[model samples]
Target: MTGGPKASRRVICAALAGAAALSATLFPGAAALAGPADKLRDSLSRGRSAEISAPPIARFVAQDGRVFVLDRTQPAPMLKFEDSPEVWVLSPSPAPRGDVIYKNDLGEPMLRATRLGGVTLFSRQRPAGEPVSLAGGGVPLRLGGLSPQALSERMLQASVRSGRAARRQVVFEAEATPASAALIADAAMVVSLAFVRLAGRDRDALGQVDSVRFSEGRRPSASLADGVLTIVVSPGHGLAGRPSSDRVAKAIRTAD
Candidate 1:
């Protein structure tokens, strides 16, 4: 699996050395170098997409347009240890397009990968056509330079394809306790219908949504952020396993 959109757009640190060069630099002691068989095993252990036993894609590797080459052999260390250090493989996600957020705050475009203390924060929080809170009383959603129609179209397209666009978060918030899980689900469904209408795409969009989550904030609130939603529900009000409100269900059934 390749890295997500954030991984691809972060202009690879120009100061960083090539993959092999970086690997050599990190493990100059040579005592930690893995043998050819060990390298083969590591490479084969990768996901099915990566060509097994094939050559690395240049020093700057990119699997599925996202930077996958890190000078780690899974990053080989300079000193061999009794057991191989476990690798940190984040969830494999579809990459995103577009470069920086197109900001002018700095004299020039900000490098998506900025030097933040010792770590790099690739400003990739907003994927193309990201979904926002459809809650009633919350502030309006700003689509950067895109219009609601355009965003909807992009989301529909993403849904049909296998990229980040298809993975949108639909949120449902409640202003009080005893919130109905069914209501939250209905809200999510309503949002799905909105996407279908906006994009004029197939109604299969409901299938794109996988995990429907729930949470409670300080007050009765519903908002979308960090690709997440916060909502309020009773302690025993278990949801996600059943249908939503009758009104919403009727609409969905009627539509079908």
Candidate 2:
């Protein structure tokens, strides 16, 4: 009878020991999972918004080693570069007012803008002999001998077309990239974009961007380093503008 009670006591002690060992084994894993979850929640609570600053005059370098400076503060912002390609005006913002000028790797001038009545226009002045054709869903406007202001009006009268042939849309989509998408996001802006080759070389020497996110409808600005290409765009109020299409076109034209 004594042996029976002693055996029961030994069994109860063994069961208790097993339970404690199992708990000890699980504690580290449970703590590990909780740690990451707690960190993520804290990060979400402290998330910050993007900041906007005054527009800065930007400089663009061409494949031919030409440098162009654009001062957005000027009444008619112009490009200052020697032997530079023709200046093209791309997007102008502020609704029915604003202008951006740019040149392509080929050094051609392509202009896009909007008028007071919310009309959009795209203009490209090819080399003296290059072909110029105006065809779209809307009536073609005669572009000859028209001042920039008048030309913008006539172009607006013409129907806006879709596809690769549309100069503004083409340039708009071309300068887009993953980094630019992040910038647009930071600015709380959205866009529709397609991926195009980097401005200079096929093999990008620029390091991989880890913190950037690319999406459809957003475009990146042009950048080059050690033969690699990197473009970044972020979101912010100061980045707001009208005729984003034109801005995109100008960026493409100016990219090396």
Candidate 3:
């Protein structure tokens, strides 16, 4: 975190070069002797090794005093901001100088992390990203189930708020389970936020929306079409199954 950009780049290059040499020494003629199938296997093995070595969970605090948690225990990386119920799954891509950039579903870079623990986060308030320091390891996120009655109550409240804001009846449908209840609550909040935004923009902004549906899936996503909004939450995401309200609201606005 203390190094300038140039220094950081140099360090990243040196570390990557060292890792390459080590891999070459361990695998010997892996590249030249590998057939197509062999090469694919080797590539996957290396990817697994990289995942194993990366921190499973990490905590960081930005210079602006905002805290963020990065959870890499799943197939995808999940990030959560301090004091927010939203969890975002980000796709990771390799950056120059061996850094990794994590992007949101819309392909916007949200975080850039150096191999040596330096992190820079991007946000609307700071489009260029602010460098943050590694604070420590963080608590692994989990989805704790809620009681059926509690789940229904929360869903009802969210629907009421959304309906009132949209000036129309807003129906919410979901299958209730302890794990899915958490997702339901999260989705409800997003629906409410989107409805509020629409109402603020236009008096009958959400009139086009009739009902919202929440369901569990392999991927978390939101889509609005034909007077129906569907929110898909992936239970495999653990607590990260919840999509950010801001992003969902934006998606709804764009779709409508």
Candidate 4:
């Protein structure tokens, strides 16, 4: 089920707003780190390493073009897909249980960590068409400067191949928000989709998201189009579970 033009606009607008808010929160102490664009470039220059001791906050560009901000403090890294990496991963002080794997474009594994205390990973890769697939039922999602039509088509193909009903929807758009735009512009590919099932809805609300995980504070809200699904990630603002879900739903409904 594709969204109408109005719905698309709404989604875009809401996304822009949410993206802006997210950016502010993620880099609270980065005022000295320059703007996101500058910081992004700085982060990219320092390539990822295989060193795994304490989960260090690092950044990398996935083959698909998504900027991943990994926080080693949680049980696992929090992931969000946009033009840039602004999503935050949170866990208890003891750190949670999860793993981080570094791989190249060919699906070859590089570094894998079994425990992450509290670290972050950022990426310098621009939008590019590359395939990245995770362990399990994850399909590699392509990321780059794709036209809406082109992105839609690729999503359709992926859905057909995966045998899952693809849902596409236009959430929103915003030009006034540079931060939001930056997040979207920085993504080069879709790495993995982490599906989280909402209670009471036998269906996983985030079943179609392309990233391995959405940021800790964000909840899953999405719309399905012709074989394409667009999931919206928003700041938690101290909310969780169904409230977060509803916030995402409302944002999508009011996007653009």
Residues 44-151 of candidate 2 have per-residue lDDT tens digits of: 466422111113354544333434444445433443333432232233323212322233323344322222112112223223222212222221111123244433
Q: What TM-score, computed on C-alpha atoms, does each candidate reach? A: 0.18, 0.21, 0.67, 0.23
Model 3 accuracy (lDDT, Cα) = 0.76
Clashing pairs in 3: none
Off by over 4 Å in 4: 1-146, 164-219, 222-231, 235-256
* C-alpha lDDT of all candidate models, in order: 0.30, 0.32, 0.76, 0.35
The candidate maximizing TM-score is 3
Query: Candidate 1 lDDT, tens digit per residue, 22-138?
Result: 767888766355576676566446522321121221122222222222221221111111122211111211122212221211112211211111111122332222211111111
Query: Regarding lDDT, does 1 or 3 come out ahead?
Result: 3
Candidate that beats the other on lDDT, 1 or 4, i.e. the better one: 4
Error of 4 at 34 (Å): 36
Model 2 stretches astray by more than 4 angstroms: 1-108, 111-129, 138-196, 213-256
Deviation from native of the Cα of residue 239 in model 4, angstroms: 18
Per-residue CA lDDT of candidate 4, range 112-176, in tens? 44432222332323222233323122212222243555444544443333233213221322221
Off by over 4 Å in 1: 1-179, 197-212, 216-220, 231-256
Number of clashes in every candidate structure? 8, 27, 0, 57
At residue 239, candidate 4 shows an lDDT of 15
**Order by lDDT, highest first:** 3, 4, 2, 1
